[model samples]
Target: MSSSSSSSFIIRIFIICGTIFNLSHQIKTIDALQPMKSSSLFIVFGRPGSGKTTVANKAFESLSLDNNKNNKHQQCIELDLDVCISQEMKDNFGRGIYPSLKERNVFASGACDYVEKQLDEKLLKCQQQKQQQKDFNLSAIISFSFVNTDLRDIFRERFPKAEWILIDTTEEECTKRINEREGHFYKGDTPDKKKKEEEVDTTTNEEKDMSDWEFNPVTFPHIILDGNDPIEDNANNVVKEILGKNEEI
Candidate 1:
């Protein structure tokens, strides 16, 4: 071929390659801009009296109201282990509180079942609502004293994508809160409210004292929030973290 003809052919090839590259880049940009379908499960946990439920509830309310940064298609649910425990007690024992180690163990197992059932239901619902091959987002905010690493592992295995949030507080502060709180079985005063009233101590009994339980990260990454901070601030920070504003969701 002549030099001019060869040059023209090379130019045509370059133009085709550039067009393909631009199209690929534009596709990626559009995908990045689009709202992704997500199933966000956040487990807010800490030792008992660390205000896990308080902040978890506040974050749930805030995230719900904001629709998690205006993702209108998202569905959010809050699950409290205490609430499940209460229900379990009421349904099986016709009581609101369980004090004995045997009773507590029974109720705790029942409560875990309840939580897992709710999670399974949510997962099924999300699976069924396959609209146009684009599933709407489902956000589950769960609160519990997930201090036992083994128990945490059970959930981590069940929901491989679940995010963990830990509310960090000193044992002293937790003991104070437990003492001040009323109407709960895990109150500061136990086994008759006198010798046990002054301090919250761990026991080697069958039913472990949750206040004495400490968190072990154990291969799982978690978002830690200061328990000393205002609950509202912690709540807002968690929402930001979950919404991918402060950190990767």
Candidate 2:
């Protein structure tokens, strides 16, 4: 089935399931939330080696094609969460072996601060252009794993209106890719340990702690995409939603 049809079917199931329990009144319109006008913050979330950055970049390209046609002063940037950490943390993390949770936490905790600092600089630049009576278009794509749910509090309550794109991929696949990929923080000089999380790569016993590991779609209005799919292909799907091409009737 087409992606849109799949979404419709899921919603129908939700509606029917709700009605069966006499809780149909609780069902609300399930719409894809758009980013704030003129300035947008698109969060591209997934696990390590799950193509989050590739997806974010492709989505940014689409953003330009769809939103910057007439704007002369347009600015778009992609911020990888790794930038939040110091060089020492990144270099020492895993010591060229698997992933390091301790160092990752520092990066995760400082995500909000990093985004605000980036936006502040961008807005300042926008103000300068506006002073010259020119219009400015500002947008961003923040790509990160956010393996810990606590990292979400860094944004949800703050930038509640930002667009969220979840790249869903299997933990096994992510681990395999992380081991195969070269020159990534998750890789090692040789095969090392698996980066396990109570949330992202949960064991059978830790199922109850699932929310602590991965981002939950039901908690908020967001679009879900298969991370294993081709980057540009997945990106086009997201663009269709942003441009309302796949918006349900």
Number of the top-ranking candidate, with lDDT as the measure: 1
Q: Write the per-residue lDDT of candidate 2 for residues 1-249, one digit (tens) a residue.
A: 999999999999999887876643334211212222345677888777788888877887877765558444555667887767576656654553222444444555577767877876766655544421234446677887766654665577667767888888887888787788777665523322333322265345543343233434446677789988998998887666544421221
Question: Where does the lowest 10-residue lDDT sum fall in candidate 2?
Answer: 28-37
User: Native-vs-model 2 lDDT?
Assistant: 0.63
Query: Which pairs, if any, clash in model 1?
Result: none
Give candidate 2 misplaced runs (Cα > 4 Å). Answer: 1-38, 65-69, 95-109, 131-137, 188-218, 241-249
**What would the per-residue lDDT of candidate 1 be over residues 64-176, giving only the tens digit for each residue?**
88864666555678998777555454443222132454554555566556766775566555455532134355677889886566567567766778888889887899989
lDDT (C-alpha) at residue 32 in model 2: 15
Instruction: Indicate the residue-level lDDT of 47 in model 1.
Output: 73
